[model samples]
Target: MNEIAVKSNPRRQRLLQRVRMEIHAELEAARLQLQQRADYHPTWDYFLNLLMRPLAPDRLQAEVGPSGETFMQFGTV
Candidate 1:
């Protein structure tokens, strides 16, 4: 059996963290703006829930190809 070790890049990790924080901040701002609308509807809560849901995985998975090359699998945000 062959064992594959997945290594994470520090730079990429930091970048991802920054991006996630920015996204969350933007979502919160949008949510607040929507709530302040004069005609806010309860049905909009469903959409807000979807927007507030987790956008992406904290860490990406590294897969080894048949040729022994490792690549990252980025998840949807």
Candidate 2:
């Protein structure tokens, strides 16, 4: 099938490529920021513990099951 080819102008092609590159760079930057935010939560907790010791509460106790003899630890680190 020898279909007639539609020629793309070089200037437009360059412009499109430039736009795509910019979008890709922005996406990568956003991904990095999200990763940093995800990792910050745990470290933030540790820092709060160190900086706000008196404000923090102690560990909690959980109710036992039907056996009524099994207690479980329940609280954030």
Candidate 3:
């Protein structure tokens, strides 16, 4: 059927509503899964990473270029 005929039909409208509800349910389920992932806790290895420091924090330097843009330079050289 043509677009206008399908759109005006009650059966077509019902079918569209059913498909819409199914897609909405899938979207909601996906959102709930993402929400659960967001609430997840990190492992012990994550905390262990915080205890380690850079090998040469003092060697890090920050300076502005001719264009007035700041950038970092690592190492004494």
Q: What are the lDDT figures for the candidates, one per model?
A: 0.70, 0.52, 0.53
- For model 2 the TM-score comes to 0.39
Clashes of each: 0, 0, 0
Q: In model 2, what lDDT does residue 24 have?
A: 60
lDDT of 3: 0.53
Clashing pairs in 2: none
Backbone clash total, candidate 1: 0
For candidate 3, report its TM-score: 0.41
* lDDT (tens digit, per residue) of candidate 3 on 1-77: 35537567887777777776776566556545654775555563343333321222222356465589986655575
| Descending-lDDT candidate ranking | 1, 3, 2
Residues 48-76, candidate 2, lDDT per residue (tens digit)?
44333322232233445558776576456
Count of clashing pairs, candidate 3: 0
Model 2 lDDT-worst window of ten: 51-60
The TM-score obtained by model 1 is: 0.54
Root-mean-square deviation per candidate: 12.3, 20.1, 19.3
| Better-scoring candidate (TM-score), 2 or 3 | 3
User: Residue 55 deviation, candidate 2, in Å?
Assistant: 45
Per-residue lDDT tens digits for candidate 1, residues 6-37, read 23766666776788889888888889999889
